[model samples]
Target: MVLRLFVPPGEGQHYIVPKRPDPLGANATLQYVVLSSTALAAGYASFAARHERRIAPPTKVSRTALFIKASGRLGVWAIVVGAAANAYYHRGFTTVVVSQLVQDPTPPKLYEKTDKYTVEDGGLAGAAAGFIAFLPTLLMRRATVPWWTRMVGMTNIGAGTGVIAAHAYFQYTGERQKAMEELERQRSRRMLEFHYIFWDKLLMQRLDPLLQAYVRHNGIFRAYHVPAEVLDAPDKYGILSMPATEPSTTTNAAAPEHAPYYIAAPDWTEHLKALNTDFTQSEIENSEREKEALLKEAEYMAYQLSLKQHAFVHSTHTNDDDRQRCIRELQIMGIAYNRLRASADEADRRIFAGRQWLRQRAAMDANAPKASWLAEHPFIPDPEAHDPSMSIAEIRKCEDQFKIEIQVFESRVRSEVREDVEMRERWRRDLDEARTLLRATDGILWELEKKCPPKRDVGEVEVRASAVEETPKVEEPPKSLNPEKP
Candidate 1:
C-alpha cells in the first residue's frame, strides 16, 4: 500500500509500490498516506534543527514551519512526477495490447491481451490512489516537532538520498555530517571569542580608570561608593548596537564617574554596553589595584629621571649654590612623588574593597544606603565642589599632616639607603684586608728567597762582599806610622 517515489536527476523518477492490498482499495491508499507523510515530516524536522543551530535566529519565519513546507513541496513534486510516468506507461501499453488482440482474433492470444489490460488498469487505479499520500505531509508541516527529532528527520532524509543516489552514499553522508558539525563548532567558538574581546575593549577598560581614581581619593579606612550612573550609562548607551552603526555617543553623559575630565573613546562607550551585569567586587578591587600599581611605577620612573637630570646639570655647571639648590629640590620632589604614588595606591585599594563591601551589603539588604554613599564618594568631584574655600587652620593642619607623612616615608627610605651603604662598606673593608694580607705574604716570600738562595750546579755558596777585608794589612800600616813618629 505504501508508495515511495524518488526522483533522479536525468532518469525522471522511480516508485516503490508496496505489496499490500485491500478489497475496497481504501487501506492501500491510507497506508501510502501514512508512509509519505512520515518521510516528509522527518525531512522537515531535520532541516529546521540544522538551520537553527547554524544561523542567526529568524526574525519573521519560524524554522520548523519553513522546513516542513519545503519538505512537503519536494515530496509532492516527486510523487506527481512518478505517478504521471506510471499513467503514461499504462495507457499506451493497454491500447497496444487491445489493438493486437483485435487484429489476431486468436482465442488464446485474446485471453492474454485481456489479462494484460486488467493489470494495466490496476496500475492506473493505484496511481489514482497515490493522491491520498500527500495529505500527511501537508498536515505535518503545520505541527511542531522537538529539536532532536528534527535532527533525526534530517539525518533520515540525508541517508535516504544517499541510498537512492547509487554512488558513494556513505562517503557523501559522512562528509556532509562532519562539515555541518565542524561549522557549528566554529560558530560557537567565534561567539565566545567575541564576547571576551568585547568585554575587554569596552566595559572593563573604560571603568578601570574611574575605579582607580575613586580609590586614590578615598582611603581604605572609610566606606565609599562608585556612582550608579557611571555603571548604568555603559549598559544603556550602546554605541556598538546603534542604528546605521554610527559611533557611540561621546558627550559628558557617557563619561565614567571619577574621570569625567578625561574623554572616552566612542568604541569604549559601545563596549561599556556589552559588559556583563554580574561584576564581582574582587574584580573591581583587582582592577583598581593594577591601576594604582602602574601609576606608582610611572611616578617612580619620573622621579628617577628627574634625579638623573639634576645630577647631570650639576656636573656640567660650575655654580656650587645652584648645585646645592638643585640637589635639595630633587630630594623634595622625590619625596612628594613617592607620597603621591603611595596615596594613589592606598586610595585605589580602599575604594575597590569598599565597592565589594557595598555589593555584599546590598545583597543582604535590598534597601541599603550604599547608593547614597557612592554618590557622596564619586570618583570625580562635582563642579561646584571643584574649588572649595578652606580656613587657615585647616590648610595648616593639612600641610602638617603632609609634612609628617613625608618625613616618615623619607626616614624609612634613608634608613634603607644607609643600610645598603654600610653593607657595601663592610664588603670593601673585607676586600682591603684580603689585599693587604696577600701583599704581606708576597713580601715574606721574597725575603725567604734572599736568605736561603736556591742551590745551583755552580758549587757551594760563595760570599762576594762589597766591603774590602783589611785584617792582615792593618798591623803593617800601624808599624809604619810609629816609625815615622819616632
Candidate 2:
C-alpha cells in the first residue's frame, strides 16, 4: 500500500507525494503494516502486564512472556521516536491544510504584520504525529530544529520512560517475591503431607495386607522364656480371676456420669493393725478392680475416637473443618486414655506389692528373732540410716522420730519378755512347743543322715546312675549336716 501525502493549494504547487520503499530491501508498506500491528500488540501486552505480572510470575510461568513484555516497552519508545522523526520531517505540511487565523482583521495597511501573526490551526488530524503535546510547536516550525528544543524533548521522553521503567521494576520484583512466597508455602504444605501419604495412599490400598504381614513376622520378634513374676499367678498371688468387666465398663448405674466413687485406702503400717491384713488386701483388690474398669472405659473411648478421626483423614474427604475438629478431639481422647493407663499401671504395682507383702508375711518363721517384734511394730527403720539423696535436716528429723519410737518399742519388748506367768505351766508350754518345732525342722533329718549313713540300694541307685562310673564302695567321712539351700 502506498502512503500518499497531498499538499494543499499554495503549499508547494498542488501535488501528491507517495512514500517510497526503504532502500534496505524491505517494502515500506509491509514494514509499516508489520510494525503497526506488532506495536499495537506490544501496547496491549504492556497493559495486560500490569494485571498479569508478565504472565503471573509463578515458577511454572514461562519466561517468554516476560521477554515479550520487556520488548513491548522498548517498542513503545521506538514508536514514539519514529513518530516524532516523521512529524519533524513533515513539519511545514500542516500550514496549507490548516485554517489560518489572524489576531485582528487583515487591514490593507497592516498586511505584513497580519501575515506574520498568522496562526495555523492543525486541529486533531495533524496532532497525531505531533504527540498531542501541550506545548505547541505550530509557530516554531522550521526546516532545522534548535538544539535546545531537541534537548528538552529528549529529556522529557527519557525522564518519562525512566520513571515508567523504575515503577515497573519495583512492581515486578514485588510480584516475583509474592510468587516465590506462594511457591514456598506450597512446598511447606507438601512437606507436611509427605508422611500422611502412607496413611492416605499406602495404608488405604493395602492395610489388610500390611497387618497380615505384621502378624506373620510378629512371632520372630516376640519374647521367649518369660519370667514367672511377669506371668499372672492367680493362685500364688491369692487373687481370683478378674471378672470380665469389659461389658460393664461404661455402665455407671449408681453414679451419674460415673462421678468417681470416693474411698481412700490407707497403706500397710503397724498403726493400722486394727484394720488387719484381710481388710487391707480386700481394699487393694477393690482398688485394682476399679482401676481395671476405668482402663477398659478409657481404651474404649480412645478406640472410638481413633476410628472417628481415621474416617476424616483420608484424601477423599473434602471437608477440612471436620478433619481439623477430629484432630483436636483425638488428642483429648488420647490424653484421657494415657491418664487412665498410667493410673491402671500404678494400681497394678500397688496390688502386686501388697501380694508380695502378704506372701512374705505368711512364709515368715515365727521362731526368727525379729518375727514377734515385727508382728506388732512394722517399719522399724534404723534412725541413723538414710538414702543418699536425703539432706542433713531431713535425716535429723527422721532420727528424732525414730529415737522416740525405738525407745517405746524397746521398753515394751523388754517388759513383755520379763513378765512373770504361772511357772509350771509356762515351762511345760515352752518345752512342748520347742519339741514340736524342732521335730518339724529338716535339719533334724540332715543330722541323722550325717551320723548314720543310709544303706545304699544297688538296684535303686544303678537305674539312674547307669551313665556314670560309680566310685568303689568305701567308708566316707561324715559331711556337714547343714548344706546351702538351692
Candidate 3:
C-alpha cells in the first residue's frame, strides 16, 4: 500500500493514502515546462545557426558571450513564466484544489490544532515562500549580453510572448479556429521575426569575437554578411561569377607566418574601396560617352532633318511604303531620345548613390548614427538611439517595430532598383534601335533622291532655259538641215 507524508504545523505524520496533488503547484510546473520548452527551442535555433556545418567552421565562442546569451534567455523565461504561472494557478487551479479538499477522507481527529491555518501563520508562511521566490528575481539584476544583443533578444522574446499570449487568449475564448487561420495567414511575418532573432542571438555570440578580431587584425570592423561580392565589386550591383583565385606567393615580410586570417578583412575592405574608386572613374568615362552619344544623335538629326527635305517629301510623289517607313523612323527617333534622357537622369542618380555610399564609408564617425548601425546590422534599428532609457521589455518592442520597418523598406528599395535597372537596359536598346533606324532612314532618303527629284517652279526653269539659249533660234530646222538624211 502507498503511504503519504503529511506535515502539520506542529508535527509530521504518516498516513496510508495516495499522494494528494497540489493542483496549483501542478499547474505552475506545467507552465514552467512550457516556458522551458520555448526557451530551449530558441536556444537550439541559436546553437544550430552558430554551429551549422555547411556555413562555416566552428569559431571560438567567448564564455562571456555565451553566459550573457544564456542568462538573457533564462531570465526572460523566468519572469514571463512566473507571471503566467501565477495567473494560471491563482485564477483557475486554486479553485479546483479547494474544491478537491472536500474529497479528503481523513477524520476530524486527524486535523489537529496544527492542521488549522490562521491569519498570522498563513502570513508567516507566505513571507517565507515570498522570500524563497525572490531569489529568482536576482537573475535579472545585470544583463549578460552586449547592448545590441539584448536589444534584439528582448524584442524577439516580447513578440514571441505576445504570440503565445494571443494563442492562449484565443484558446481561452474558444476562437481556436480563428487563431489558427490568422497564424497561417501571417506565417511569414511571424516566422521571420522569430528566426531572425533566434539566429541573431547565435550570430551575436559568434560575431562579437570575429568582429573584434577583425579590428585587432585589421583597423576597422567590416560588418559580416555584406555579401562577399558586394565588397568585391562595390561599383556594380551584383556579384560577378568568377573562378576562385590561386594562392599567392606574395607575403608580408613583417607579418607572422602563422597569423590568422586578419588579411581577409583588409583585403575585403580594400577591394570595396577599389570598387568604389573604379565606380567613380567609370561614371566619369560613362558621362563622357553619354555626351558623345547625344552629340552623334544630334548630328544625325541635323543631317537628316530640314524643312526643304520635309517639303520635298510632301510635294514630290512618293510610294506609300517609303512614306510609311520614313514616318516609322521619325517615331522611333522621338521615342529613343525621350528614353535616352530618362536613362541619363537615372544613371546620374545611381552614380550619386555610389558616391554617397563611398563618402559614408570613408567618413564613418560615431556608432550612434543610423548609418553605423546599418553597417553593423544591415537592417536592424538603433534601439539606444531611439530610447536610451528603454528597459529590456521596451527595447524588445522597439526591435519589433524596427524589424517590420526594415523589411518593408528593403522590399520597396529592391523593387525600385529593379525597375530602374530594367528601364536603363530598355533605354540602351531603344538608343541602339534608333541608331539603326537612322542608318536605314539615310539609305531610304538616298533611294528617294534617286527615284524622285524635287519639283522646280516653271519660272525658274524658263529663266534657266533662256540663259542657256544665248545663240537664239538654233531651232531653225534641227531635222530640215539634214533633210536628205530624214
Candidate 4:
C-alpha cells in the first residue's frame, strides 16, 4: 500500500499496508471537484447577469452599461476563482506528496518520480476546470446568444437563466410593437381630420363677407339705426296702409281684423333671423334647446300665414270698404315683397360663393396623396405581409361619404336658391297688376265724390262720419277680378 504511491512491488517487495489513511479525503476526486466548480461559476455568472437586467432601467444607456459591467465583473470573478481553485489543488497535491515521501521506505529517486506525477496531474485538472468556469465568456462572444444570456452550456441553471432572458427580450419586443401601432393609429386619425379641417376652415373664411351682407340686408336691427326721415315716411302712410281692428257687436259681423298670414319672402327672412339668433346663442350659452323643434315651428308658422293670405286675396265678394282694407293689406305685402327680392339676390350670391369654395378645395385635394400611395408606399414594402392597413380603408370610406354629402348639399342649395329667384320675380309681376287695379278704384271713388258733393263745412263733417259708418255694412256684388288664386 505504501509503494502504491511510488511503484509496484513483487517477490522481493513485501505486501505493505498503509500506516494511516491517505491525507486527502476519499471523496475529494479531482475531476469531480473541477466539474462542480465549473458548473457553480457558470450559474453565478448567469444569475448575476439576470439580476442586473431585472433591476436596470429600460433606457439604452442603462441596459448597455449593465451588460458591459456584468461581463467585466464575470470575467474578474472567473479569473479570481479559477486562480484560487488551481492554487488549492496544487497545494493539496504537493502536501500529500511531501507527507507520503517522508513516511515511505522508498528511495529518493522514487520520491522524485511520485512528486512529479502528483504535480502534473493536479496542474492538468486545474487547467481543465478553469477553462470550464470561463465557458460563459465564450458563449457571450457569439451574437446569437442575446447580450443578457451570457452563460454557456446546457446545464439546468444556465437553461433557467436563458429562459428568463428570453422572456424579457420578448416582453420588450411586444411593448415596442404596441407603441408602434399606437403611433400609426394617431397618424391615420390626424390625416382624416385634415380632410375636414382643410375644407371647413376655407368655407368659413369665404363666408365672412356673405355673413356681413346678411346682417346688412336684414332690416331687424338695422331698422333701429335708419334715418328719422325713413321712419317718419312709413309712419305717415300708416293710417292709409294699416289694417283696422274693431270688435263687431253683431254675430254676423267679421271678427276683429289682424294682418293676414301669408308665406312670403319676408316670412323666410323671419325664419332666417331665428336661425341666426339660435346659432349666435349656441356659441355664447349652454342651452339644450333642440334645433329641429325651432325649425319646425318656423316652418308651421310660414305655412299658416300662406293659407290666410291665399284665402283673402282670392275672395270674389268684397265692397269698396273691403277693397280699401285689401289695399292696406297689399301695402304690408309690398314690404315683404321687397325683403323677398333682397333674399333672392342673396341666395344667388350664396350659390356662387359655394361653387367657388368647392372648386378651389377640390383642386387642392386633387393634388394631395391618393389612396394608391397607402397600398404601395415608396418607403415601405407591401404592408399586407405585416399588420393590415385598416386606416387606408377608413380614409377612403370617409372620403367617399364626404363627397356624397357635399354633392347633396350643393344640389339642395342650388335648387332652393333658384326657386327663391323665380318666386320673387313672380311676386314683382303681381304687385304691378295690383297697383293698376288700385288706381282704377281710386278714379271711380273720386267721380262718385264729385257727383254727390257735401253742402257746407258742418254738414261735410257729418256726411263723412255717416259715410265711414255705412262703409262696413255695405256688401259688394260677386265679381272675380284676377283669375289666379295666388
Candidate 5:
C-alpha cells in the first residue's frame, strides 16, 4: 500500500496542542540529514579532487585506498541517515503495538496522566494536552512509567541533530592540505637557518663531497616513500634495472701458460668456470665503466634514494642507529669521488680538479642577505663574505627552535601513521607531492646538465705565462732539511 503524506487527525487531539504535521520535528530530521549529507558530500568531493592534480607520473595508490579515501565518510553518513529514518519509522510501530495505549478517560482530580500516573486513569490527558503533556519532567511521583526513559530518548534525538549539524559545517568549510609543500618549505627554512649545524644529521656532507663534482648536486634532506608502481617496476621510472656486475676476471695474469686449466689440478679445474675464456681485460673494462658510472647524476641519485628508502621502510635500526647506519652507507658513495682525480692522464686529473673547484666556487658564491633577529630569513649563512659565526647564546637559541620543530614533526608523523582517516589522507597526499617533487627535481637537473655540462678539457682552460716580458722569479728563504712540527 502506498503511504499518504497527509493523514486525517485522530478523534480528539491525539497529537499534542499546537499540533503540526511534525510536532517533534521528526519529519525535519529527514530533511536536515538530506541537506547536511548533500553539503558534506559535495565538500568531500571538492576536497579530494584538489589533491588529484597530475604530478608528472601521479600517485598510483591501491584500489582499496582509493575507495576508503573516497567513500568512507559518505558511508558513515549513510549509516546515520538509516538510523534516523529507522527511529522515525519505528514511531508508528511503538504507537500501534508497543506503547501503553488505553482508550479509557481520566478519573477524579487527575486531569494529566503524568500527574495521575495509574493504569486506570488513561493517557487521554497526555493526548488531550498534546505530546508536551507526556514530558518526563512533568510526570508526578505516582506515575507508573519512569521519567528517565523519555528523558533519555529526547537526549538522543538532540545529540544526533547536533552531530549532523557539526559534521555538515566542519566538512563544508574545511580545506584539504597534503602539507607536502609546507613540509619541504619548513625543511628548507630549517636547513637555511641551521646551514652548518645539521650537516651531519642529514648526512649532506657525505653526499656533497662525492656528488658536488656532478651538476645540480643540491642535497635532498628527506626520503619519500616510493610509489608501488615505481617501486614494482623501477625501469618504468627510468631507473636502471641492471644487477651488480659479476666478477669476470681471473686472479692471475691472462697468459695461456698460466691459464686456470693449465695451472690448477684437473679436479680443481672441474669446479672452475670460464677456464677456457680469458675475462681479465673485459673484467677490467667493466670495473672502469662501473667507476665512471659514479659521475652519472640520475643513477647516483637513485642509488642514494634507495639507501634512504630502505632505512625508512625495511631496516630494523631505531632512532640514532638507523641514521648512523644510513649515513655510513651513504658515505661509501663518496669513495669514488677522488677516483677520477687519481687518473694517470694529466688532462683527466686537471678536469676532475676543475670540477671540484667549480663545486667549491658555487658553494663559496652562494649568498644570503643579512637580517636582524626579527627580520625575515634571519641568521642566513654568508659563505665568502666571512660573516662571524653564531655566538654560544645564538647557537643555543637556534637549537631550542629546532627542538620545538622536531617535536611538532614527531607529533604529526605519529598521528599520520595511526588509523586516523584524514591523517592518512594527508600522508598519502604528501606522498604524492613528495614523489612528484623528486621526479621533477630529477627532470630539472637533467635539463640543467644538458645545457651547461661539466668541464672536461684542461687545454681550453690552461693559461700560459707571458713569454715576451721577463717576469721576476722571487725565491723564498731556505729551510732546514727537517721541517718544524706544529
Candidate 6:
C-alpha cells in the first residue's frame, strides 16, 4: 500500500492512535504493524530536521545555473532557425503540388481539388521539426547536464547555433581560467607565508645557536678575523649561542670539539641532491692550488704595505723641510694598505670556496679518501686528519714575519711616543710661565687693596629741642589752701 501526505510550510503536527489487538492468532499481524508505522514516522521527522540544518543557503548563482541560462538562450535561437528552414522546405513542396493540380484538365472534385495538407498543418510540421532539431539545446538547458554537453555543443554548432554556443563556451572557459589563476595565486601566497614564518620563528630563533657553535668550532671567527662587535650584532649573526645573562665576551677559550663544522636545515641535503652536479677530487685539487696562489700573493702584498708604512713613518721624523713629502708618502701607504686588505679578503674567499667544494665532493663519493689531497700536500694538511699543532713549523715562519712587523711597529710607536712626550714637556713649561704672569697680577691686586682701603661713614648723631618747655612748667596753686585765703 502507498500513502501520500503534504505538510504545510511552517507548521508541524503529529497524530497517534492506540488500539489493542488480541495476542493470539487473529490480530497479531496488525498489532506489530501499527508499532512499526509509529517508529518510522518518528525517524522521518528527526532526520528531516538534521538534513535541513546540513544544507547551506545559496548566496550566488552557481556555474551550473549560469551555464543553463546561457544554453537556454542558445536553444531558443536554434529552434527559430530550424523552424524557418522547415517552413521554406514545406513552401516548396506546396508549390510543386499546386502546379500538378493546375495541369489537371478534368472537372475538379472539391475534395480532390484541395491540397492534401493545409498551411496550418505545414506550420505545425515545421514547428515539430524545429523543436526536434533543438534537442541538444534542450539538453544543455537542463541544470543536471554533464560538463561535456556544453563542450560538444560549443564545438559542433554552425552559424546560428555555432555563434550562440561559442559565446557560452567563451564565458565558461574564461571562468575556468580565472579560477585556475586564483588558485595559483593562493598557493604562491601560502608558500611565501610559510617561508617567512619558518625563517623567523623556526630557523633563526631555534637553530641559530647550533650554527654559531658550528662556526666557532670550525675556527670561522678567527679565520675571517671578525671583530667581536660584528659577530655580536643581531642583524648580522641572528643569535648568539651563549646565554644573554652570561658575560658577552669570548676570550681565547677552546671551542667544544664535538661541535659541528656546519649546521644546516634537514632539507639542505635534499636541496644539494636537486643541484645534480658534484665536484670531483681533481676539481678540489685545482681549487686548493688556486687558494695557495692567492694566499701567497696576499702575503707578498701585505709585506709591501708594511714596508711602505715604515718608510713613511721614518721620513716624517727626518726633517721639517720634508714634512710635505712625508705626508704624500703616508697617502701612498694608505692606498697600499687598502690593496693588501682586499687581496687578503680574496685569498680568504678562495680558501673557503675550496674547502666547501672538497666537502661536497667527499659527500658524493661512495668511497672517499681518508683525507683530502689538501691534507696530503707537502705545504698544507687537512686540519682534521692531522694535529694542527704538527703544522707549527710552517706557522713558525708566519709568526717570525709577524714578529718582525710587530717590532718595526713597536719601534715606530716608541719614537712617536718619545716625540709626543718631549712636545708635552715644552707645552708644560710654557703653561708654567703663563701661570706665573697670572700670579703676579694677583699680587698687584693684593698690594693695591692694602695701600688704599675702602671706608664707611659712621659714629655721629644730632638732636634739636624747642625752648617753650620752660614756660609750660609755671604751675597752678593748690585748690584746698586757696579757699581759706580768698
Best by lDDT: 3
- lDDT of candidate 6 over 228-286, digit per residue (tens): 44433422332221111211211113334333212222354554343212112222333
Candidate 1: what lDDT?
A: 0.38
Candidate that beats the other on lDDT, 1 or 4, i.e. the better one: 1
Residues 56-146 of candidate 4: C-alpha lDDT, one tens digit per residue: 4352233333343444444445546655654443333223232332333332122212211222233333344434554655654434333
lDDT of 2 at 194: 20
Better of 3 and 6 by lDDT: 3
User: What's each prediction's TM-score?
Assistant: 0.20, 0.21, 0.19, 0.15, 0.17, 0.20
lDDT (Cα atoms) of all candidates against the true structure: 0.38, 0.38, 0.39, 0.36, 0.34, 0.36
Model 2, 362-469: lDDT tens digits are: 544333354433422245374233222223223334434434544543444345343433233433443343333334333443433343324532123213243233
TM-score of 2: 0.21
Cα lDDT tens digits, model 1, 1-486, are: 222232111110101111111111211222243245446665665766677555446433465455544444554555465456544433332222323213322121111121112222333343343333333444554445433334333433333343333223323544334333433433332233223323344332433454434323432212124233423333242221111222321224443433322122345334334322222232344346445565766578686867677676767657888778777777776776677677666656556554644554454346556444343446546533332222222333433443454454344434646555544443344334334444544555344334432332111112112111434444332222222134
Compared with the true structure, what per-residue lDDT tens digits does model 5 show for residues 253-290? 43343123111223322323222111222223333443
**Candidate order, lDDT descending:** 3, 1, 2, 4, 6, 5
In model 5, the runs with Cα more than 4 Å from the true position are 1-145, 174-486
Residue 310 lDDT in model 6? 76
Model 4, TM vs. native: 0.15
Instruction: Provide the clashing-pair count of each candidate structure.
Output: 8, 0, 2, 3, 3, 1
Q: After superposition, how far is residue 101 of candidate 6 from its true place, in Å?
A: 99
RMSD (Å) per prediction: 37.6, 41.9, 35.0, 42.4, 34.0, 47.1
TM-score of 5: 0.17
